[model samples]
Target chain A: MNLGVDLTFLEFLASLPALVEWNDFTVGLVAFAVKFAILVGGLLQLPPLLVWIERRVPALMQRRRGPNRVGFFKWRLYGLMQSLADTIKLIFKEEVVPDGAHKVFYHLAPVFCVFPAFLVACAIPYGPDLLVFGHKIPLSVVRLDVGFLFILAISSLAVYGVSLAGWASNNKYSLMGSLRASAQMISYEIPLGMSLIPIVLIYGTLDLGKIVEAQTSLIHWGVFAAPFSFMIFLICMFAETNRAPFDLAEAEGELVAGFHTEYNSAKFAAFFLGEYVSMFVLSCLAATVFFGGWQVPFVPYETIVALAGSPNIAALAGIMMLLLKASFFMWVYIWVRWTLPRFRYDQLMSLGWKFMLPIGLANVVGTAVVLAVLRFK
Target chain B: MNPYIPVIIVLIFGVLLGSILSGLAAFLGPKKYLKEKMDPYECGVPKVTSGSEKMSVKFYLTAILFILFDIETVFLYLWARTFDQLGWLGVVEVAMFVLVLVVGYIYVLKRGALEWD
Candidate 1:
């Protein structure tokens, strides 16, 4: 594996027969299992961290100390376990099934919502390689050629789950919330998809690993090469995840509790967890795709990799750097949510169709012209 | 290259297992004959059964139209995937398709198919 370049498990596996080791698929599967286990374990902590961030940061911005009283006196500053306590409290709360709600669809909605995030994570390459039974095993779960498209399709599916949840709830408010969410998701998806095109065009590949690798070449980092597309992507991603400024569906002043209004207990928790996880995943994706994934900017690849002593250590460092970058994005999300006020529904729609869409189109044209000129030169 | 057979087998097995379990549960579960539970209640009023229901066809028509356009978008995805092999001509073809769809959308907007009374 090259330093500062993203390499998926399959790419490593394809080169493995030349290297001296290796029995068959069993080692590969076990390595994959380990990577997946770690990803899930690490990912589970994000919601707790996000909860603490969301609760505390908003208070800081508003000139108050939020969640300070919840933690032990010694740990008052950190109140990290406040989210854990909240989870336990939510779990023990009585589950309620509202009358006239479509029982099947209502029950299925949370499962639908959560699964997409999990599936999308499979394409995300976290580390370089795993050491299993004295053999080096590649770390990613799976890599598809159409990984980017797969994520996009999964995002689209999330809207269906939300829509079904709202429509099946049989409540007027729930229906309205779902309707708003569906429209918002569909509208944002256009720009989100469009914004991705310039990067894809620049990289000349739809595979996410390849996209990240393209960025490691220094000059090819999509953000620097095409700033307009990056901006469009960032704004669209915010709207896509239904964060503040674009969270009309969950606008508490308008729709009470939104699509999950009648939901309770674990089902409600599932929706909440799914939302936070999706938010984390989107931020991670933005970091990886546009900001050059795990690569340290301006530092030559050889210097870091040589200092790290081996490809394995270099890969581990890459994973850590990627996680750090992703966490920073998560913090930024909390910061923005607290800092910014919500947009009116009309403003949100206009931003999507009237502004972001045209800009995204322009970015694609601009990228093509630049690439063509470079080729000609 | 073909992962189709295994995928199909898994799908079939899943559907069969789900159907059997749910079917058996429905059959074996306690069958309590209750009047209130069986009857359709709208705002707690006992509903008179069986009549030619007065519902507008427009709602159903719009839903059908939405489904059609949604499926057309799926075809557009396929075109996108193969666009490189099809070259600039493929781009033009897709543009034409999207243009036609936009025209249809405009027509529907003018006709107020999207409006909810």
Candidate 2:
């Protein structure tokens, strides 16, 4: 209740609703609103652009001209407007909640898919901070002290959406596909959680902002510090996101669109959007943890600020840097989708359990030993 | 200025956005349902079996094992965060914990419980 004293994260969490100071509360609310508008708003829009890239990149890779027809007036816009056209068509398309489907859950499934995706996306710090009128503003929509753990916890909730969609459709394929999807998600989740432990160990911090601060030195970036962990994390990211090679649950040739075999119109599009948004969010996390979230490589935050003569510009550059790194991974996601063959179902499960899980566990112990020895030295 | 307020705000916004996206087509798009069209996609043929039939038990096995390993993984996070302060003792403790996890994992592997067939 003491307003003058500093409070821990838990204290802040427990002390909510009893919070006084009307002016500060209003200011913070406005700040959050603006951050949401800029960050989460962009996340909502990013799927369409990613869809364009998904189409165009594969076309380029396969030496084929992709949707170049849809354009503004004459600009062609590199087929950018194609996604816009598709989004409109998707919205206007008739929705079918097939007979024998559970009406309530069928409608609710996409909401489950989208809600967690947005929450996790909003938690990711886009850049360092913007300094205005000598006031500091963190770039992310919501900054949880346990940001890394929070992301892990919330993302696990996304599986329900897929599972529900699979089950609610009241089809044999839907039931099997949902079961496979949920099982795959939970199975891969072990390795994903294991893979990330080394990041917390190496940085000795749970707050992603602090993790980025720890990695300000290029040599200390997460990928270098725990390259093995990054490799495991990379594999798990694919499995967790249900991306290609690990996309056994929704194997179109096998499962007939998998868990989403029944959803139509924007409901179907919701699952698609959720998948891409999570992909982007995970890529951003990887970039932040492995590549230094907002830190310019070799050039530290202070250096950027000093060179630009404004912290705001430095932050902007850092945001672009993080986005660039994340987009590269995004491109990799698309590239792999087109390039790699899907894994057999058994192979996917075995990889998670027999391989990545043990390696991830060992990496944690190995990292701890090294860190402890280094400290003693 | 509690930091948790944004969590609520984000939740509300997400729910609104999700519902709008999911519900938009219902009002905007025309709907004309037929008996055949309402049936599930079974390669354009009649159903051979009831939907929601029992699936392979392998998924259930995986889920149970995941619950065990996932709980263990989360426990490590606490040790990982304060690892610098805990130092060598923390390393030893986590190693022992993971050692148990590895042995259990080996048992699961040996049991052939994860085999899909």
Q: Which candidate leads the pack in DockQ?
A: 2
Q: Which residue runs of candidate 1 sit more than 4 Å off their true CA positions?
A: A1-22, A72-74, A129-136, B1-117
What are the per-residue Cα lDDT tens digits for candidate 1 across B1-117? Answer: 232332243334333432332233234334455656443223355645321233345435534664555465456555545545665665556657666766876676677655543
User: DockQ for model 2?
Assistant: 0.73
Two-chain DockQ for each candidate model: 0.10, 0.73
Candidate 2, residues A66-149: lDDT per residue as tens digits? 989889898898889998898899899998778889999999999999999999988888888888655678888888899999
**Candidate 2 residue spans exceeding 4 A from truth:** A1-23
Per-residue lDDT for A112-194 in model 1, tens only?
67666666666665655545456765445565577777778766778867888887777666776777777777777776776
| Tens digit per residue, CA lDDT, model 2, B1-117 | 667778888889898999999899999999998988889888899878877888888877888898898899889998888887786777888788888877888888898987765
